[model samples]
Target: MTLASDDKVLILFRHAKAEQVYGKADHERSLTARGRRDAMAAGAWLHEHELGPELVLCSTAVRTRQTWEAAVDGGACGETVEFDDSIYSGGAQTVLQTVREAAGEAQVVMVVGHNPTMAALASGLSEGDGSSAAHECLAAGFPTSSIAVLRYAGPWSGLDIGTAALERCHVSRG
Candidate 1:
C-alpha cells in the first residue's frame, strides 16, 4: 500500500543500557537504574517534541521491554506495544522488514530495539539532508536510548537506503 507523499515517519530507538549479569542470558538481562532513567528521559523527549508514535514495535528482550515500560510510564507514547521476538536478534534488513509490515494507517511508527541493527538502519535510511547535527550524532555512534527520526514519502514497504531524510537524532542523558 503506497502512501501519499510526506505521510510517513519512522523513529528508530535503541534500547537503554542493561546490567551485564555474568550468567544471565543476553535476552534476559534487565536494565540498570541508569538505564531506566535514560529511558524515561528518551520518552520525555519524544513527548516534548510531539513525536509520540502511534504504533510501537519493540524487541522482546527483558531490557527492551523494560525500556519501553519506562518510556510509556513517562508518557512518551501511547498504549499498544507489539513485542516481537525477531527484533531481539534481527539485523538491519530484518528491522526494515518489520517496519514495512507495520499497519498501513499508522502515520508514526517507533521501533525499540538494540544495535548495531538500529544504528545501521538509521544510517542506511538517512539521506543526510535533514539536519547536520543529527547526521553527525548518528555517525558518531548509536548510544543506548538514542533515537533517529526519519521522514519520507512512500509506503513502508518501499523504505530503502537513502530514501528518507534524517529529521533529527536524540540521545538520552540520564
Candidate 2:
C-alpha cells in the first residue's frame, strides 16, 4: 500500500448527466445525448493532457459505465477497467478504501462514479497550493462529467486528508 514516492496521480470523475425517468431504477438510468458528448470531451481532455489512467474503477450504473466507454472511445485511456457496485452508492470513505486497494504498479488511477462522493473526495484530498482556476472551480461545484486530478507522494494505502495537491480540474461543457 505504501508507494516509493509521491509520484502517483488519482483522477476522480463524476458520471455524465443521465436521463431522469419516474419510477425507473437509478442503476438503469442511461446518459443523454449531451451526456455522451460531454463524456467524450472529458476523455479527449485526459488524452490531450497525457493524464490518462492506467486503471479505471467505474461504478456499475448504466450511466457511469457508458461514460467510461465514451472516455475510452475518445482515446482518454486504454487499460484495465473494473466495474464496482460499491461505488454506485459509496461515499468518500468507500472511495478512499477503493483507491487504497489499487495496484501499486499503477501510476495513474481513475474512478468514475456519482457525486457528491466525487466532489467530497476531491475536496477532502486536496491540500497545499494548486492551480487557482482548478481550486476555484472545485469550490464552486463538481459538475457532471467533471474531472479532478490530484497528485500524491506516497503509497495508495497512505492516502489521507491533505495528502495530495490538486493539480487541475476539468468540467465538461456540452
Candidate 3:
C-alpha cells in the first residue's frame, strides 16, 4: 500500500509487563522475563508485517527502553531511536506534542510508552472509518505489548482526534 506524499504511519506501542517492585523507582523498573518474550514477539510481528518504522520515540523509563531493545533483538529496525522524557509520564496530549515536535523526514513513526496514555492516544487519533475489528479490539483495552497501527494523510503536527484511521491492532504475547 503506497501512501500519499504527506501520508504518515503511526504505531502506538504499550510497554510490556514490568516488575512491580524492582528495588528502585518506578522509572527505573525493568521488564519482566515474560515481558522480554512479549516484546520480542511484538518485534517479530512487526517484521513479518513489514511495519518497520523509520523513527522510534520511546519513553525514558527503563521498562520502555528494555522493551525496545528486546524488540530490536527480535528484528525490529528503526533508522533512529529517541528517548523522550515527555513519554515517561506525559499524558496522551503531551505525548502527541512530542510527536508534533519531531523533526525528521521519517514517514513511519513508532511511539513506545505506558498506558492509559498509549491506549488513549491511539483511540483519540483514530477515527471510525478504518477497520471495525481493529476498533473492537482496542475497545477491549490495550494489553501489554499491544500495538495500534494508524494512518493519516498529513504532517505529524496536524495529527489530532479523528484525523487518523486505525488500520489494525495486535497484542503480542510470548
Q: Please give the ranking of all candidate structures by lDDT, highest first, separated by commas.
A: 3, 1, 2
The TM-score between candidate 1 and the true structure equals 0.93
Which residue pairs does candidate 1 place in steric collision? none
TM-score of 3: 0.96
Q: How much lDDT does candidate 1 score? A: 0.86
Query: Residue 16: error of model 1 in Å?
Result: 0.6
| lDDT, candidate 2, 37-75, per-residue tens | 999988888888887677889999999999998887776
What is the per-residue lDDT of model 1 for residues 51-143, given as tens digits with 9 covering 90 to 100?
A: 877789999999999999998776687545798987887898887888888646677889999999998888888857688999999998989
Off by over 4 Å in 1: 1-6
Instruction: Compute the lDDT of residue 122 as modeled in candidate 1.
Output: 87
lDDT of 3 by residue, 110-158 (tens): 9999999988998899857579999998899999999999998877888
* Candidate 2 colliding pairs: 3-155, 6-153
Better of 2 and 3 by lDDT: 3
Error of 1 at 78 (Å): 2.8
